[model samples]
Target: MGTTTNIIRVLFISILIDFLEFTIILPLLPKILTYYGRDTGINQDSLYVQTMSFVQFIQNLTGAPNDAKWNSVLFGGIIGSLFSFLQFFSSTLCGAASDRYGRKPMLLLSMIGISVSYGIWCVSFNLTIFMLARVIGGLSKANVAIILAIVSDSTTENERNRAMAWIGAAFSLGFIFGPLLGAFCSQWGIAYWPNSTMMFFIVPAVISLVLSLINIVFIIQCCPETLPIAKRDSKQTTITDISNKILPWHLFKFTAIHNVKSVDDIIILRRLGLASFLYMIIFAGLEFTITFLVYNRFNWNSMKQGKMFFIMGLCMALVQGGYVRRIPPGKEIIAAISSNIISHTNQDL
Candidate 1:
């Protein structure tokens, strides 16, 4: 029991750090895009320039407002989408690999990749390099899923729900603090070295890098292998298997779940999966673009954006911790429907 408690604690901290590093760039995206877009010395024929040109062309073709603010929003959306796209595949691959190997090894490998990504960001002077950093970060973002797996491996069925709720709390806390920390670092850099453009971004990247490195060290020294050898899945996951897992058709059909024996259960799972997919689509679109919208409309600097995220995170934490977990099991659907209706109605108003 003591070991299980310690393992859960480590998993919680690991996830918190992962989200903290991930969200640090949220409030800074608009400014980051602006900085990269205005670099006059970058070669016009380079990949970065070409990509930016294509984005600008799309914006112009779509008849979007011709201004730096809106353009930054569009560019930020593209970057955000690109990250999600890579993560979509990499997460499946990581989960499969973890099943074959142990969870600890795969978790370490993902953390290493994430740490290297932040290291690259620290030196990213151009949009191309910055995009590369995002690519690496997205591909390495297997921490959350793996941490949940670890919790499942370590906890009993009765304790699992509570443990997962704590994981949700970690996420909320990360979002609450990470953006504020990033904004503070940016402000500090600007105050001390107002002329240094590199320092403005590098400060946040450096902090993220340091946190990831610390996480890596903590895992190496403290985290134990949660999956026992007898329970391990020894099958080699092939390219075809991976392709099947990630492909939209197979995913929508719930083909990866081999244990469900009943047709009705499979149908229910598919419907639930589809609902989640649609919800995430709407949620992600708003999430990625909200910073840009606020910046454009209110001229919000990093600190103001950070405060907004803090409030959003705080509200989410309060709701999840205080109300969401206490709902009776069968009433989840009703609660979800009610929340969505209220959310959309509020948005309309």
Candidate 2:
């Protein structure tokens, strides 16, 4: 098949697989905790109830005295903002790493990080542990960026878009399935207290670990280095460029990376940055709204909340992946983030 076909294929598989892995937890946690088992435990169930209750209790006073809805929204925004900021930072370093160390190593390392993140979920004792897991996972969170870099290195310019699309599909699938799959696995036992919640993370983490190992042995080993022209060797960039070879990712960091290459470049980058910020803001809002909605409106136990999220995610994935054939990329798409180039021109330009 052609590059388009390949891109679609890879993105389809990657997103689906990842969705399966990630969505499993969204719809199961609440139910699994309370009433799923034949012989529910007095001790364990009580402990779990206390643990989740305490976590939410602590979360409430975490900031201003806003209503629970506002507080939850703020919390979700904080996490998204932090992760977005982190992406800017890690991208620079890891992209640089791809140049020095190679692509496969970074991919393997990132996968390992993901597995460990899920592993922590499996063993979570309380809210602190749960929050910490998200933090850790966020730090190592450059899967898409790193994969894009790998594809850029491996394929020609004409082929890069397709490669990227395939990767996008992988991401979509993961989002769709992660909660659902976690719910399915979490469904295994209802008698235990935290185990109900913990198992969801446990099974996925184990699977993630196995997947990482396979990636390390097979995929990473198989792909060849893409940065054929060494950073130091580029005649166009010059010796000054060699000494100043900063990794070129701008999404994750406040640290400037080789100040916008040109006026046009600056404009382009600024627009993208602002748009990304806004997108995250909205996404954070939606995520928090759903989380609290299930908690208060429905009085859903953890398992029920998980199930709700799973269904929501599945619908989103099917629509985006199955129907929305391809997402356009490049300056036009980037410009889409900034609805009005006129307003941001001063800042971007």
Candidates in order, TM-scores: namely: 0.94, 0.64
Using alpha carbons, what is the TM-score of model 2?
0.64
Which predicted model would earn the best lDDT? Answer: 1
Misplaced by over 4 Å in model 2 are 1-19, 23-88, 155-158, 191-218, 229-262, 300-349
Candidate 1, residues 217-303, lDDT tens digits: the string is 999998999887888887777777877789999999977788777999999999999999999999888879999998889889999
lDDT of 2 by residue, 233-327 (tens): 23343444333334334333323455455667766666667767777666655554455456655676555666666565566556444533354
Candidate 1 global lDDT: 0.85
State the RMSD for candidate 1.
Answer: 2.0
